[model samples]
Target chain A: MFDRETITNDRDPLRAQFQGMKGKLCASPELKAALITGTPLHTPAVGKRVHIRRFSKAIAVYAMCALLLLGTAIALPSLLKGMDPTSASSSTGDHDCIPPAVAMSSPSQLYERLLSEPNVVYREVGTIYFQDGSVKTSHVTEMTRRGDLFTTLNYGDGEPEHVRYYDVGGDKPCVYYNRNDLWFTSELRGDNATWAHWCKAYMAVNWLEDEHYEKTADGYKFTEEFIAEQIEEFKCEDAEGTLTFQDGVYTLRVVRHKEQFREEPCESVFEIQISFGNAPEIVLPEATICTHEYEVEVIPSDHPCRYGDETRYTCKICNDWYNEWSPTVPHNIVDGICTGCKLSEEEIGNLPDDDPDNEDHSDIIYGPYVEMSISRPSMQEFLEFYTVFQRKNTAPIVVTDLGDQKNSITQYHFYGGIINKNTFPDDYDYDYSSGEIRVPIQFWYSFYYNCDDAYFGTYDYGIVAENYTLDNDAVIDLDNIRLERVSTGMETFSAKHELSAKGKKEGEIRYYEIYSGENRLMKFAICAVASTEDSYYDSICQQVVDGLVKLG
Target chain B: MKDPQDDRAQIVENYADMVWRIALSRTRREEAAEEVVQEVFLSLFQKERTFNEEEHLKAWLIRTTLICCKHYLTASFRNATISLDEVGDLPAMSEGQSTVYEALLSLPAKYRIPLQLYYIEEMDSDACAKAMGLRPGTFRVRLNRGRNLLRELLKGEGIDV
Candidate 1:
């Protein structure tokens, strides 16, 4: 391998050799022949511009003539008459005064004369589609002409995208995009355009006339009189000129007007400001006649828009065509139906009554909570908060017990009560007339948790632990609880459930106490919704936990 | 008002060698190279666009020679680069030229082009980089790899490193 060091070392020497080689090649006779005859030729110097084979005889004859001319001075004047004007001319002053006239070939006159008679192909036009799904047909009324690269696109019921390749010569070909209001270069070279113009003009002028125009009802339907009349009413303003020189060819064309006609509205032409060499003039050629028929078929036939389930009010006319649950209105469709609802509870063994003074209520801090609170501190307050919490957090909040994954906390929902605007339980704190309750802060470190998919829904819940209430007015702190963002767009505090439980479940209560053990762990995950509106409640709940919950 | 003599002299001095080399490189036919070299220079003389320097002169010669080669080999030229690679591997005499120069003759265009610009043309990394449209750093890497591959044949023939 030629590594960097070797390559760098060789660079100077190699360049020196290259220079040497160039000199040798330049001096080599083979190279000289290659330069001149493009092949090695064994011959003496021949006259410059003399073809290799034309040498021997031609030079011999020329030398003999020169010798003869030197011998005869009297005949020399007549022999050299056309040869050297320099020696015979009396004065050099006459040469400086008059310049020879240059002959100009007028292709434009040839074009005009060629176009004076109707081009046979003009009777037969070809149709092409425009951007807006309307079609226009163009006819070659004259020889395609050397300069015009005009093509038409139908714009709606009129002209929309108008393009003309003008000044189509030179290295950079110029094209005019009228509708876009810009003129720029086309990628093709000018010579290519000239050759193409030659071919098209030849075809347009020479192709046998197909009276196909008369055969079609719409063909050539707008006669010269109608086009002239339309041109009279049209506006010609904001015209621009374009010029180009390329590939031994030069062209200049000016655009005078772009207008729609009053009577035959779709018939429009670029009123061209024409210039061949010196003079500039105007010509109105009917190029594009925009049609309305093609626009209606632009959209696919089976599209929902065609079936009348459109966003616009116009689609409502076809409302009877579909059901209220139609996917056309995305909001009405949902993943699964809410089939059943209920409340149940299982308790840890009852707590013995203790003195309020030594109870240490300092451990619980309830909220930055929102929603209705009936803080009457009745026996019912503890029952309702416990019930609602369980209904909301069905997914057990996992907590780390030991360092191992196996030793994790899981909640078993034995029983809890749920009450809402529609269903309110008796013996609940405030009747349906008074709404949901609030609890304050708590946070902790915990292991990750996953809810059983069968039990998780758009709304699901979990319970931490409960407290006995002195009355409905007693405030509870929620400082030790752990919950994760299950799904967003949850109507957070909207539902209130009040439960009255006369429960004794031996093992169930023990499990609740085990979950509430001093080492109960907590973790959090952010739940995001697709739409911005849906993320609000989830953001608030996450913030509330952060502000109020703390772990030691 | 230009004299034909001056134009012919200018074309010969400027483009004759470049046109010959491009045609020879492209067609691999000496006769074709001869034909193309003459035609290309003649055409340059006839064409109106004026060339002022070596770079413009070279570009015109290369472009014209390429067009002629494309016309001559229009059939097999479609995959001519592959043929070029096959030819680039031939042996060379100890005179600092390798058959790889011939093999370079065989080298497919993809390989042959970079090789020529690097070695034969004496174009440094940056110039080769511009010609190949590759970044200089990339051209350096490609040149190293291509040289190493060409070096394989030399190693087998007992050529000293």
Candidate 2:
């Protein structure tokens, strides 16, 4: 009777026979030649041939005339206009001295003219005073065209605090942070809408119909008032503005009032100046554009061709392909040559009245047999090989320092009958009640394979604490760290440290440090603390220490 | 750095035996097994694939071999009448062991392939499940059912297994 043990444990003679067959098949001379020459014994059927006979003489002449016409159509415009005068003049002085096309009479007229113009430059300054005595000021220099807009705004000093660019008619505008090489896109409304409105208002004389108009010595002067009813649409309580146009320049002054709460009144004043012609060029720092390109190369079969060898094909990106091989009928071999093909063996056993349909067929035996060792482990063996000691609690405990510039504080968690938070006297305050470890630490139960073919199950956890200082007088010994430096052959010093405490519940901690020169780059610690003298905890801890992988 | 061509050759050499074993377990014919192994290796060689470890490579080969075996079986020109007797002879074994081998081969391809990977290849149930694209629990159920079927077949043949 075959039990589960026998089925799982018994060595199958078939496996050995098959393995021997594989060795013989791979060592075949035909396969070796095919692999080296990169050629198939049977040529693949060619796809339907696309035959294009020679073009007729009349058709060829017609195609030539069409090509000539296309060339003439492309060249006609450039030939008639010659070289552009503006492009030919390379001097910046000559370009800047170009006169304005016409004088703009009104704000609306100026805005209409500027919309058609390529570049328009202007500056706007706005200051707001709140009831709480808080003040915010924004000074901006900007340039704009039909679909393009660029602006630099300063909140405090003359230096730009924020720089933004918007291709107005297209996608989202990308704002660039100069301090950090950070760029992000946001929606077209909110602050961006306000900037767009300011730029349009600078060129136009009567963006909003004026409440009062007066003729000044230099140019036309106009004033407009937005009451509480109309202010909501403009995102303000009430607003009053006056605009003056003089000699291709427009000056605007606006005051806005808002009451955020019942008693908190806020007021803002804006001064804007717009000048026609000669807008400075907008230059942007280079940035990488994220894209992907797929490159494919076909790889032929690596092995030589056998009696039945499939066509090998490959695409270099993801491992996906179509494979086909010729099928061959099994044939009997006598003296290393196929007897089925020769018909010699059948002729020797000839019976005059033998019917081919009723004849019995026997299996063909192939040559050059090799010994195969097939000893499969039983179920019990598998269990023993895969079993290992693993900790129940895989949650990570993190120690952090929170103190003044020089003060150092270390945190620890000790669990023995109940959870206890231990706080020592130090200059820094420690809070562990949150139960959430803020540092980048991850923990999970995982299986580990040992050298003895046994699995040592472990509570896998990793710590990522960067540039942490260990005070000399701290409870944990700082100088007694047993460090083993690993040469990664890079500019960083990678090391592992093992430290253990013998008193009370035996605790073991494994610390890994990565340093660049004298500066400590990163420090990670994996600790296993137990209250009792349990060997399982120690074994699991040891396994975890051995399985530590340094991430660069 | 290893040249791409050399790396491909090494991959083919190292995993050819395993791929053939898997293919043979499914098709049960030497020619079909050879065809499936060639198809699987050629498919792997043609693509740009990155394996994380040896386990991943073996798993990919096993999975691809099974897929190729399926494709070969479904081909219009496939000779379904090709019996085990026509292919080759097994190494001499006792009557009971021989019966067990026949019973195992008689099981459906889905159940037999997993059993072969688990018992013959010595892969863990998890690895077998991954290669066969089955959940661990589902694979265990299928394996148990397959063993029961084999046991019944052996009993019918008047040999307890």
Candidate 3:
């Protein structure tokens, strides 16, 4: 039994110490300085680990609705061009590859069909040896009843191995059966490595058919035969370039002029080859090994990349490396804690001159990081200013450091690419179509350094959501925006907008307009350095556009 | 009836002492406890459009304050990135010893939150149960356990209740 009165009689004596913390918090020298100076204080959102928490229900609903509509709009042209799943383009003499009359079904139904009926009879047998001195065998088979959709399997003799189904326009290895046409799919599985690794290889091989893209800017025009030749010619040894072996890693630098790099005109162009082990499997794609003009500095992490660990953290940029996406050396901090990394061009130029032991360094870059670069349009500009942050530009998002102690680091992440929904043909397979307006969002933040204390990254606060309606239709005419100093009587803030474009190669800027409590204007000016477009991806961008439309 | 956003901001400005006191009672550490108050007010500001009236927003703030305080206790164990080594440098008062305060700091997260909500927050046991997201019977059990632990800790330090 407990003494009820005694138990209930607890109180906090330190209550008096915090009599006015809220008011004081607003007036604190640190927050006040940040509010006025506009210089970020601590690990600014810019280079921090991109921790996108689940959106609130209202926001999620608003965004999803917009995206769904956008997807439908962008997809209509391509969908119309799709002549019954099995039919080929009437204009081209090429064989009608798309299957028709494919009965569309839910993913669950497809899974059940593969499981119960053995209807998806994939039967290509292969053996794989595991690193742990073990061997396993696999067989793959396919079945397409209505022609377009194909249910497929890659399994052991009788057991259900990794199974999948593909709608006609699905991405590679996912299978693309012509709707009403006869299509065949092959499957292979072996314990050569893990299931995931083997699956990656199989998918890569089967989806190896050359894809022909009409010449756009820096694009490739490939056919099945050309792709097969490229695949056959591919040898870790005969990569046709200079091989620099460093730290157990081998790198081949392949050069290509801006124009010759692809079908479309290329502005930023460079190519290279890199390999690690004796296995040709270690070879990376041409895009992976290429180096660009900027430098990237990956924040060092004390935690080595390992399984089950959430390796989500941020890195700092030294400000001076602003506006350049460069290669990075992943590292850890002094506290034995792992965060993000900064990327820089300088780091790539000074790679530890070729060493055989650099095998670990050659591992492929994954996960998300920021890419920072500065661009002054260098020409006269025009209307509603907007900032467009891109997730990827051939090379993914990279971060650079501004040596300025105030805003030490920032990042530009490869947000993913945007398609001109207007330009995308209706017949193209599963594509994200959209009008010219786009917003590929990215994060930017900085830390307020304390010499007496150790702080791993910069810290500043800002909004994180799919999209925000501009006060005015200010995005189209990007020239109206410019960076300037902002005064709020007691504080100051610096403003800037960032922009990125692919087709027309135009720029946009973003700025903040401050209004007083009395509805009187306090500050109004164009700003720069931080923005993204809504046109980055089909599935996701469509929603942002919808959000904008809903707001409208 | 002023704008709800402005009204809620006023409640935060006016009742901040009440919120911070409850937070300090639970967290014991001042900076983190202060952060809890800031989060509560910031949340009120961000969600200003949702509340029906001023009082409703106040209640939400108070509830959020308790949750934030409880979160601080659990968060402290896993995210002890900020070192507590310097906490000893602060000077002690010449009046009564702050043994109970120290004792509360030593208690586990589950016990600390229940005791603070009931005693320092001035909420009834049922309200405490609601705020902590627990059943009334469970809330009573937690209170007993917390009170016993505090007594024992203070007893060890030669402090009479």
Best by TM-score: 2
Top candidate on lDDT is: 2
Candidate 3 has what TM-score? 0.26
- Chain B alone, TM-score, model 3: 0.72
Rank candidates, TM-score, best first: 2, 3, 1
Comparing 1 and 3 on DockQ, the stronger one: 1
Assess candidate 1 and give its TM-score to the true structure. 0.25
Candidate 2 lDDT over residue span B45-64, tens digit each? 55455665777678777876
For model 2, residues A362-381, the per-residue Cα lDDT tens digits are 22111111111111111111
Candidate 2: regions farther than 4 A off: A1-552, B1-9, B77-79, B90-99, B156-159
TM-score of chain B of each: 0.65, 0.83, 0.72
The sequence of per-residue lDDT tens digits that candidate 3 reaches over residues A1-552 is 986644544343333322233232222344323323333344222111111110111111222222122222232222112212222122222111122122222112222333334223322222222222232322222232223333333333445433334422222222222111222232222212221222222232223221211223533223323332333323222122233434432232322222211134322211222211221112211221111111112222222111111011122221111100111212222123211111111122222222334344222222222121321111111001112223222211111111111111222222322222222111111112212223222222211111111111111112111132222222233332222221111111122222221122112212222222222111111112222332332222233222322322
Per-structure clash totals for the candidates: 61, 12, 154
